[model samples]
Target chain A: MTSDRFDLGGGEPIITLRDIAKSYWRETLEIPVLQGIDLEIPAGAYIALMGPSGSGKTTLLNLIAGIDRPTGGSLEVCGHELNGLDDDQLASWRNLHVGFIFQNYNLVPVLNAFENVELPLLITGASRGERRDRVEQALALVNLEDKMKNYPRQLSGGQEQRVAIARAIVTDPDLLVADEPTGALDAKNAEEVLGLMERLNAEFGKTIVMVTHDPKAAHHAKHQIHLEKGVLDKAVEVNR
Target chain B: MRWLALIWKSLMRSKRRTLLIVGSLVLSVFTVAVLQSLLTTLNAVTNNPNSSNRLVVRHKSGLTQMLPRSYEAYLRQQPEIETVCALQWFGGYYQDPRNFFANFASDETTLFQIFREEFGASGISEAQIKEYLRDGAGCIVGESLARKNGWKVGDVVPLTGTIFPINPRLTIRLIFKSPKPSDENALHFHYKVLEEGVPYMKGLSGSFWVRAHRPEDIPRLIERVDRHYANSAYETLTETENAFNLAFVKMLGNIGAIIQGITAAVVVAILIVTGNTMATAIRERTTEIAVFRAMGFSAGRVLVLLLSEGVLLVGVGGFLGVLLVNLAAGGVRSSLGMAMPFFADFAILPDTILACLAGALAIGLLATFVPAYAATRRPITEGLKAVG
Candidate 1:
């Protein structure tokens, strides 16, 4: 691991960040979001990113997910040097290795549950029969097989999140990056969604990186990484 | 191909908006189709294949000025001329002015011979032609006119003259059918009837219809006949029947340019309307587009999906517009056929239909490309931040 990196003491590292810096520009003004960040996340580890508003947690998450690029630094994910890939290459790389879950459960309103979950496989050139079998399996894993034909508006918040989870994992991606997975859910639904994520990590051996503000939600992760003012502050292992 | 469903669903996301765009496209396409078909029908009158060997000898001033009947003898003297027949526009209506149609007075013996194509073996029988020639008060009407007025052989038809002062009661000796519907809406009678009815009309004819023995001989005959009577009191403007028919079309005053201008305006309007609609739709789906991009869809792929949706929408509308116009063609022909004989055979040609469809699709691609490409080019993070 790099000198400033956190060695999580899990399996081999699947994501490595070194001297990562990101900044946004509002015309002539340049505002820094993340600065001097070094981190290594081991394979199959569930890590939670906890920070206050505008703490750059989401920006860091975006960089690691290959959806955003750092102004200065080298980043690697799933054995691919993300810093070296162009925008299209990064997109293809993401399709192969990363899954994203947004806080708002950004499901395409026109597509039903089945089609939503089947979206990733479409770009992969999967056959119709293969797509059907895999979509059914993913929906079943989320316990939403019965609601396959329901549109996003027809489902409750928790069910919608589950459907989003099904879409995230349908391609068997190497990493799942979620932003406030339980932000919009009630206590019972949030608990149910956290339990599902826990099952995905412990049972399916999926590596997950999640960002949340709620302490209870963070406790569900195997480890908690905190950021303050765009800098990594500390890393702590959960007792559970 | 798999993306087609997603594209279709996205179009249906806002059903009302999609329907409104389609409705606008239909109106635009319909207007263009009708205008284009009018131009095509008008062009057909000037390009009638059967009139290739025929020529008209009208007064140099205009159709209103009468030509001397002696011009037929001079026209027949040319070796190129196979038949020469004196014709005058009777300008008469049957029973009432509202029941108007084309009625011409012509030389009886040479009338059928000059327009053999219209009264050939496929049209009136030989016996019917002979019977009509034997009767001075006999008149021959097209089958469509006979059908309209419910007249058959032996019916005494009375026409009230409009330009002339002679009202002649004539017996229908024969009914003939021509290939062109416009040709099938005219009535022809013996010019002698007009001469005997009005003494002042004795030696004057509206024009002489001349048939050349060979198609190649017509151009030379036109030049010869016009040069023969140039600068005379009754100077002649001799032209092929096609050019003669075009003279009437020219009365409409730059109709082709007018139709083309209207078509261009409609096309531009449709492009603006469709483009604005597509931009609005893309704006509303900014987040959804960002979601697709984040799911690993390339910018190019997303653009293609949006473009497909646009093309499909306009394509459906264009097809319906073409279909609606085609179905209404018969009614339009019959209605306009009564007022203008040229529109009796008006139709939407296959080439025009294809051209309209192609134009609609091109508009679709152009209108959607700018907005869709812009949507795809936007930063994924910015798009993600957008609510709708």
Candidate 2:
């Protein structure tokens, strides 16, 4: 039921968080993950969440991706209040609106590149021909159309990451969230992935939120936000 | 439908684990099918379709005690009794104790009329039946028994008696074949040879087999004969041929109970092995499952995928196991037909195969439910953090 209720319309912020807090429990003790966080990411804006390891940058990114719920405060992603939806509803929301890229390039080992890219589309009611065309187009956009039949182990770190990127953008999602997309890659491969992400943001106008500690990786985005100890340190807009 | 391919690929991820679990399931189901089918074949003898209008009169106490031979003439006086035959158990062995079969001393003149349903059919010719009736020292042996000992119609067969007093060397005048396998492994001789050989057996025989005029006359004839001999020196217990065969099965000491116990044990063993393997498999795929949940697959979908793996594994195994039973049935029929007196046919029933398949499916589902549900119920964030 796509209705006016879910319509924040064009040029609106895709993600808006206010006083968001997440915590864990160790018996009776409370371990706070992210507290008193306020952030907004607009449509077609590329941003990086930069922080130390335990700064909860990944947790914050996960919340924005609708993968986790904030224990307190409000979270709105793609015009849907995530806290208002159940776990199942949030999952559907993620499938439609957000694409995920993980640090290790979490492609299913058994599925080849083409099948891996076709996973999200399988959830949709898209016909087989449509899914096939879209998968081929996604792989061609990532410049790995030739490696569509290769399993994950048959490809190198950079090739695997490219296949993962194809999988991420195959759904043509409004938002792409990468949690250290290049952390497991070497210098050359990391440079290739960073360039590809920049091309996706600049050429396609696809929004991206990346979590990484590497300044080199962070520089791929138009805006950089540093988080320290479950708190937002600063947000800076980069030129070029 | 594409999910089916995913399930297949996921199950094939660990080939050694899948093979091991499937192998265990096949072994257990094979053993269960064979055992239960044997029990079913044995139980089927009670209502043997070939035993027509026949009643066996034994001692009121038990089969071992001798009955008066004069009861045959008294039974012949009854209007319902069409014919009577003296059937004394000749517990005999041909060459070895392992080479066992049914050998009885029956009234040669009336034996054909009494058991014509089993013998006078297409398997044995009328000429062979005449040859058996003509010679006093003649014997009728089933075709399977002849093949085992390599005896032809003119061969002189000597069987050393275990329970009776003497050994009888007689010509195998007739080699008869029967439709039933157990019925084909038998030897019947004249009761006079047995009585004349043993002095005390002259006036006493083991039992009497009486054929009535009609199938409906059996119950009334049984009541009449037993009541007539109720307080006599050789008091008789008379019953239908089905009940008579059932008594022999009962003498084997609760075979149905034993079969059920073994089947239950085998099923439990399969459940334990398959359940443990499924638990380990599900544990290893925790992160993958969490990924599916994150990708909008509901918990029920994941459960279906996981449980389908178990079914595909065990269901294929059970099918192969039941197929093995069918393949080996001929050999089983021959071998066990030689060993057991009541096992006429060893076959895998359609019901048995269906039962095996249903049982395997049930075991697969029951084994995977706890593990699949457990994997699905864990928080997606926690599962996503699992490394292996």
Candidate 3:
């Protein structure tokens, strides 16, 4: 544990983990999901987590996204320690500092692409004008400005994923967490979505943590961390 | 606002299911409306104080017992009793047994005076009334029955008696149109004619109708009349006409209770069916609800969406039912044929519609409790995992 205090002198690490572990109870048997993990990522860092199935890559991404709490660990994101926060506080914190992109492109089926992308701004107390401007800018970054009014079902797989990416950066959060962002797409669509993520990282300086097992998807990130058996194996820095 | 749009889209997703639920609500509310109208009309006819002015004096034992015809003269002697007439229920039928109508034999002289508002020939002169009174075998029939039987003035009408035991043939000298159409149709003739025609009914009258000096003094006058005949050979039981009419309705037992029970059952059944439909709707929209919650909608916002859908369905249904009931009021009154009065007054329409809306809102709240809680309680991680 890091004394339960933010090290503001070090300019606040975007994410900090110390001995993080998570377990599930299945019929009275303890199923350890993540065991004794320690890591840190600074602001404006694009990090990719790669691992085989059942290797806790998605679990780690969830912890970083503030959507799940670790059973035993000291975890901090955006200068807030998340160990003692209640569910509502965590939700509020996620709304303010985190944006997520799911592999399935979890856009609300009923709303148009612009509305889905603008959702994160609703909880931030932003004015309507500010929300509209930011949502439009984000959509234009993903080259989806023309398809803003189209629903998720009307868009192609590549377009839906691009809308999801636009949603992730619309809030201008300090951290973006995407789990298997390209897992459900064909090769052509996946490459298009990867190109959009790379553009978001380079053009906007967004600190992103993407979990994917595909090497081609990992190549879009500046750094990749592999996980094996609930432990971080190694890290590799990739060039554009 | 965003959440509301989402809910509207989700409700529109299955048009057939939504229509089915709404149709069921319409049917339930329609039935409730019609039943309430029937009860209201029956209550109005039986309890309207303005229409009931004829006091009924029967035997102290019961209506089955008869009073001597001589008591009619004795009753007329009292200054408070303005005019006296006797009526014996001649449970008679016309061409078909199902063509039921009220038949009574009364003194023609006072029949017109006592029931002046209910019975009067629209165009006939007083001389005709005097002539009809002079002729012992002359009769007066209601316009409805006259039209049904195709009997006009001066036409002979034949009626078979079930209680008096003889078929009576009389000439209708006058056709009385009801001054108030809401009043029951009655067939009236001379008591002397009936007595002369049937030898066993020589000195007997079933009940007496007395006109009081003041309507408010009816209760005191009834006590006075009963006291005067307290020890007579055939004791008299006197009551206001409204009370007398209500006694027949009361014979069916607590009608109000029966109606309340039936209405309650109908409401409960509707609630259950509607609740089931709403529960299924919420269950099927679990993923969408999660999407809303993740989009920064509060738990209360989701609840409002569900409740709004319910109100829309039930409120529209209730309004349609009210319109249908109002449209059918005249047909129901004519079909009931003197059994029920025309009940056009829907004073409780607003409250009934509100009750239906409240019932729907309650169903919405109850059905969505589990799903709303589940969605709000879900980890965003799990909710996002629901994709694909």
Candidate 4:
């Protein structure tokens, strides 16, 4: 394992963070969650964020995904400076550039797998045929094309997570931010999900940033960035 | 339109909750529709177009008061009057008191002449009129009344009078149909039956119905008749037939206001109920809403989706309510017509139906707006942490 300053050295970075700070105000009390974070993640690099609880790992991921606006400093993801964009503009930018995978699988219970995967495309003004093709391709890549009509309730934990992955990748976004992606799955299902993530990173050249506490989950990434008390340490390259 | 499936599925997410809210809306909308239609039906009585050329002459004191039978002769003497018929309320029932209906004793000689548009317009032959006048104990019934009582021509209808205390066994000489439903739910017999059966009522009448020669003659005839008997012992109150019907409606004392007030109250109740229900439903979907927001659904778009779900719910309920009222209108008309002559044509007007649906949509938008907007405004991260 080799540790270095937080930069993957080859192509232009897809995500650039500079002196990023985020704080939530609970009434009059300002609670700082992340402060003065600076990092650059090159395109096609699969990375994991590891930290103890309350270390702002998810908060940093939220900032990178453009779901949360930083209180100070600049965030540029996929070449768009996020700090200058308004909330709705940021949402539109996220729709085009970012995809999200949540820990609990977060599949809308009322929607079947196909509809869940098709959700992100609904806002893109994509033609019906285009959306259907993209959704099918995403599901086929996740190897769950046969379960397109099954609802989340009918799916196993592993299947639901795979469907979530399908949903995240359906739009073919530039960045994928996942928070605790395998937190709820059993060990076998977790291994399967991590293998799928490896395939997404290696075969599809997708830039993946996932937050997890498990060491084995972090090992699936090419590099692991650790955060403690809103500060980022050096990145460690995981040797095969 | 593309989001319709999502909205529909979300609304149907909790089938029991959605159904309960829809049931409440259906009941609320049904109540308002029926009450408004009843008010419209009552108003139609005073706006009847056929009554424009007719005048009613009643005792000056009130409707229940009696005028001298000689007033008919004076009414006929007016140059503007084309025909006159003296009528007395013979409030009667059939075999049972529960079968009560409006029955009147009227001058048979000029009955058809005064109501030619009502009785003759529907193709009643001259022979039928003559037969009714020729028989001493004969009556003319509206087609609906005859059908309701299973009576045909030459059938004997024994009406026991409540006010005059007399039983008149009269043959149905003519069964006439009128365009107005109210007119078709009444029975009219020869006034001579009461005149001879009860001697004291020989020279008294409840009212006189006068037909003017032309529509323009009604106003002048009304003025002239009231002026002629202004200070007499049996002073007369003359008005157009519409005003006469309106006077009866006015006797109910601000009934329209009462219905409107109740309707408004019901609408507010629906809003509160539906608002509370939508709030609960949205609260339960906090994580899902956050998931949608995280998936790049803008706040405004999500709000619209939730509102569409609410409106579709109430819209369906309102449509069913209006449909139910329309389906049951005939039975309601028949039952009310037997009890009150003014409600004989009870119907839910199209305008009322439109108004109900519009009101439902407005309520849907209103009831769901606050909760859905608040849900959208919530921090996506905070919402994502919410449990089911």
Predictions in order: lDDT? 0.91, 0.86, 0.75, 0.90
Query: Which pairs clash in the backbone of model 1?
Result: none
Scored by lDDT, model 1 comes in at 0.91
Off by over 4 Å in 1: A1-5, B121-123
lDDT of each residue in B28-64, candidate 4, tens digit only: 9999999999999999999988788888899999978
Q: Interface RMSD values for the candidates, listed in order?
A: 1.5, 1.7, 2.8, 1.7
Model 2: per-residue Cα lDDT over B1-388, one tens digit each: 2877888888888889888887888888889999989888987898787666889989999878999788888999999989999898898888787788999999998988888877765466667778888887889898878887999988998888899868899899988777776888899998888888999888788889988998888888888888998888878999988899888888888989999999999999899998999999999888888877777777777888899998888988898888888888877887777777666467789999899989999999999999999999988778878853
Q: Candidate 1, after superposition: displacement of residue B67 in Å?
A: 1.6
Write model 1 residue lDDT over A61-115, tens digit each, in one string: 9999988899989899999999899888888888889888988999989899999
Instruction: Locate the minimum summed-lDDT window of 10 residues in model 3 chain B.
Output: B339-348
Per-candidate chain B TM: 0.95, 0.92, 0.81, 0.95
Give lDDT: candidate 1, residue A4: 31
Q: Best-fitting candidate, measured by lDDT?
A: 1
lDDT of 3 by residue, B1-388 (tens): 2545655666766788877876777777767766665565457656765535568889999878888888887778877767888888887777777677777888787887787666543666788788788777778887767776888878877888888778788788777776545443567888887788788789988898988777776777788889998888889999887777777767768776777788778778877877777777766766666555544455555666666766665666656666665676656655665443223222334555566556545655565565555656666556666664
Consecutive 10-residue window with the lowest summed lDDT within model 3 chain A: A1-10
Residue A64 of model 3 has an lDDT of: 81
Clashing residue pairs in all predictions, respectively, total 0, 0, 0, 0
Q: Cα deviation in Å at residue B107, candidate 1?
A: 2.0
